[model samples]
Target: MMRKLRNILLTLLLLAIVALTAGSFFLLNHALRPADNKGRDTEGSYAYMFQTYPFLRPWVDSLRRAGALCDTFITSADGTRLHALYARATRPTRRSAVIVHGYKDCAVRMLMIGYLYHHDLGFNILLPDLYGAGQSGGDYIRMGWLDRYDVIRWTCVADELFGPEATIAVHGISMGAATTMMVAGEKQRADVRCFVEDCGYTSVWDEFAKELRAQYGLPEMPLLYTTSMLCRARYGWDFLQASSLAQVAASELPIFFIHGEADDYVPTEMVHPLYEAKRRGGRELWIAPGSAHALSYHDHRAEYTARVRAFVRRYM
Candidate 1:
């Protein structure tokens, strides 16, 4: 009887493993499949979520009623309707700044910077919901590769709304930071005044490696690397090659690179080398002593705000 019970338990374990494997595959397939642009479009997903989770509607409504904030839509080159928020300073300054949020985070989390620049420093802010996040278009998270185009579109929108002569500065955290870096490297983004990148990874592959090691205790190069390669082959874009460190190092634009000394998510070591590479140019690197990943802003709020304000004040 005991032998039979043990055998049953082993079979159940095998079945559980199979179920988990199948579920993971199904979730991945759903995530990567892009929605058709015509009838079943990306915007429909946002509408469904808004209807199901009505709490977000009130939060967005409150931000709009705050007087200084204006919500707008941006259309990507591929006709994707991206959602963005523009905050005008009460004092009406010509200097404009754009803030982009990271993965799984919407433009609402960027309100902290908008409040600082718009109210405290009297600078206008343009905050956009990045692709695959918030009210933006896309299904799967492409990290920062395709998000670069979304950044460019919003920058153009800002230029049109604020005029060509308005000095534009960009501030981003995590994935947004990577997107900002990629955008700054583009020749069309030259009108940007300065850039602020906080806690951004050096490459998408390295980030995946770190995450995989944490979860599975296995080398990510062989598995995650191969998976990303397959994703690129399927999506027609290289996911592993998305990065801004090399491009930013060779650029003439002023850049402020900030990272937490204790950041384990995308180690400061990866960013440190790039920061060192750009030391000769218009660059400033700040590593907060006790911060971790995205917590650098909260850990050293005063210093972070002061340094960012100083940079923008100089360029803008």
Candidate 2:
């Protein structure tokens, strides 16, 4: 009787694992697939974004009118044609700023940052559409793992455009921020002096696990690990290995970390540990009060700009 009971328990355990694996696959492929962002296509999405900063469109218009805007393309190492928008600085400074946008975001959405860098900060700006997003060609969204390599390419592109003496600083929002951290870890060109990451999660696995728990009220254990395996098999990358904490801990680049205190999307708690993990000499962090995910600039532009400017002055 005891032997039969053990056999039944083993069968139930195997069935449970099978069910979790199937369910996790369905959830990840359907929910987190590299689909176009519905929010960006609608004017409602930009209403708050555009309206909050009235000068954003005018700055873009002025840049275009002045013939400073250059829409360019670069082919990735894998032959994917990547798109980026470059704007020359008014003051002819060799300093370059490469802006990386978040998931499902295009290069055009980064014009506000371009304006800040080119017009106010006296630095040239390049905004790239990440692989598998916008005009860039790819089948999978790398969630900042592979995007880090693309950033290295962009750094080389910046050097090619502005010459080798150009100084570079990468600034990214959300997924872009995570990519910047990953890039900081990689041994790349010396032009990449510093990085600014706003509201970035710790890792692909951690973020997905948090999402699973929050959205579906599901435990991560078998489901998340199973999804990681699926991602490895299908996407050629594992979510578990794409860790920003490990990357940042391995780098010596100066990093300015910013996050909204009220940010539940990426969670404010994640940044503290990330900032604490800094092995580099230069690191700064700010938690904007009353702000939500990626909205620190929207809530407090002056403070954001000031802190960023100070960071640039000190590091970049």
How many clashes (backbone N, Cα, C below 3 Å) per candidate?
0, 0
Q: Summing lDDT over every window of 10 consecutive residues in candidate 1, give the lowest-scoring window.
A: 33-42
Clashing pairs in 1: none
List runs of model 2 lying over 4 Å from the truth. 1-18, 34-36, 39-52
lDDT of each residue in 1-316, candidate 2, tens digit only:
9999999999999999889878967876764564556423425534544676788867767776988888789888888898888887787777889998887676766666776688778998888888876667776578899889988898888888877789899999988889988888888677788889999889998888898999889898778888888888887788879998888898888999999999999999999889999966689989999999888987888788888888876756
Best by lDDT: 2
Report the C-alpha lDDT of model 1 over 131-225, residue by residue, as the tens digit: 66667776666677788777877877888777777778888888888877777677655567788888887777677677767867878544554
Q: lDDT of candidate 2 vs native?
A: 0.82
Scored by CA lDDT, what does every candidate get?
A: 0.72, 0.82
RMSD of candidate 1 to true structure, Å = 7.9
